[model samples]
Target: MCLLLIAWKVHPTCPLIVAANRDEFYRRPTKPIHRWDDGSGIVGGRDLTSGGTWLGVTASGRFAAVTNVRDGKAEGTPPQSRGALPTGFLDSTATPQAYAAAADGDDFAGFNLLASDLDELFWVSNRFDGAGVAVEPGIHGLSNAQLDTPWPKVTAGKAALAAAVSEDSGAPDADVESYFELLHSTDPAPRADLPNTGVGVRREKQLSPLFVRTRFYGTRASTVLRVRSDGSFDLTERTFNSRRQTGETRIEETS
Candidate 1:
């Protein structure tokens, strides 16, 4: 996932809510979110080429998601795929901190990972030094740089998410459609506000929007995952094909 907005332990009834968009090349092969028939008990979209997932959740209440760091100066492909980072955590019984510490950051390209066991949440980034730090209970944002980096999109997204959560809090059911509407925003940041991530200005401009749409590369999926107080969760993913919504998959499981 490229853009992630999270509201953790903020609502009265829900404890965790995540809204994310996964951006990738249009030619990349991917499978829409679904349960792993391999008995992994994991539900997420699969990167068919790499055989790993961007974000996923388990019936046991474990959740994980990862986003690649945008660094054009970094040369040489990393030895491992960053997708494995999240799947590794979801498939393990270890606590978030321990799992993050054991991960060999040098083995993979720059990445930011979020892991949770429904008890606590942690954020780890291979691009920086230090172990995974516990994520505070509040609304947070993440993009290509770092957690809560205040990129234009991140800032706007966090505010939009907070408003959405506020409107849905205490309600009988979450307004899942509203969350998707937020992610569907195609408005681009002003040129003066765009960040220089080493990608050329043209490319950077193309990626400045909350929902990216380019000729070859753009947001491929938008996902919303909500975990209620009872441990029951809802996950919905919408896949896109050249800016057109192609399919959607939703999974809701009771505790």
Candidate 2:
């Protein structure tokens, strides 16, 4: 996932709300959200190129998401894929802090990661010399730069998510579409607001919106996940191309 907006322990009846867009090349092979047949109890889209996931949640209420940091110097592939961060977390029994603390940040390119279990949320990043820090309750955002770095899209997403969660009823399906609408924005941030991430000005503007569109690469998926106070949850994932939505998957758990 390239942009992540999370509302943690903020809403009255909702404990967690996630709205994110996974920006990637159009030709990369990716499987939509699904239950892992490996019995890891993980449900998420798989990056077929790397055999890992960008975002996911386990049956035990563990959640994780990962985003790559935008650094021209770190453009080439590293020793490992960052997708393994979230997949590895869901596939293990370790707590968020423990998993983040033990992760070998140097093993991969610059990346930002979020890990959470039933109790708390944690964030770690190698680019900013980050460490495992427990996140407090409220809205938080992450993009290609760093966690809560206030990139235009990150700020917009964070506000939209907070509003959607605050206005929606407590039902599992309520406001799901609203969250998607929030993620579907295409407006680019103004020039002054765009972050100079080594990518040129034109390229930066192209990638500034909540959703991005380019011929070779863009946002391939927009996903919204809501986990209620009782542990019941719902996740909706929409797959896209350069033009329109190709498919959508909705998974719900009442328990």
Candidate 3:
């Protein structure tokens, strides 16, 4: 997941709201969101190349997501796939903090990970110094960089998510299409607002939008997940090929 917008414990009826986009090369092999048949009780899209998932939720009320850090530097090869970080947390019985704190960041490339056990949420990053920190209740955004780094897309996404949540206040469920609409915005940021993470201005501008598109690489999935106050959840994932929508899957589960 490249762009993750979260409204945690902010809404009256919904405790957790997530809107995210997974950006990757078009050639990568991926399977859309589905329950794992391996008896893990996990639901998420699978990275066929790595045998891991970028975002997932378990029937036991666990949630996890990951984003790679883009510094445009050559790190040769990392020992592990960042996708495994999230997969590990969802498959574990440990608390969010314990799992995050025990992670061996050196094994994987630079990444930011979010893990939640429904009662609490924690974030860990290999590129940062801390082990894991508890997330406060509110609207937040995360991109390739650290959490809430104020990039153009991150700021815009947070505002959009806040409005979506506010507009759906007192309702039992959020409007998933509104979140998808925001994720589909293709407007690029102004040159002055772009972040230079070693990528040149041209590439930076290309990746500035909430939704990114290029000749060979772009956003492939847009997912919206809401966890209600009663411990039920609604998850929707829309898959894309280039700029065209290819398929969609929605899942609802009651506690």
lDDT, candidates in the order shown: 0.89, 0.89, 0.91
My TM-score estimates for the predictions, one after another, are 0.96, 0.97, 0.97
lDDT of 3 at 158: 97
Give the alpha carbon lDDT tens digit for every residue of 140-166 in model 1: 998998899988899999999999999
lDDT of 2 by residue, 1-255 (tens): 789999999988878889999999999999999998998889999999999999998767889999988966646568999999999999999999999899898798888999999688999988776578889999999998767899999988888888898887868758588889999999999999999888899999999999999999999999988888777888899999998999999998778
Model 1 worst lDDT window (10 residues): 167-176
Please give me the total number of clashing residue pairs in predicted model 1: 0
lDDT of 3 by residue, 1-255 (tens): 789999988988878889999999999999999989998888999999999999999878889999999999989688889989989999989999999999998899999999998799898998987999899999999999999999999999999999888887534454567889999999999999999999899999999999988999999999998887777788899998875999999888787
Tell me the lDDT of model 1 at 179: 88
Top candidate by lDDT = 3
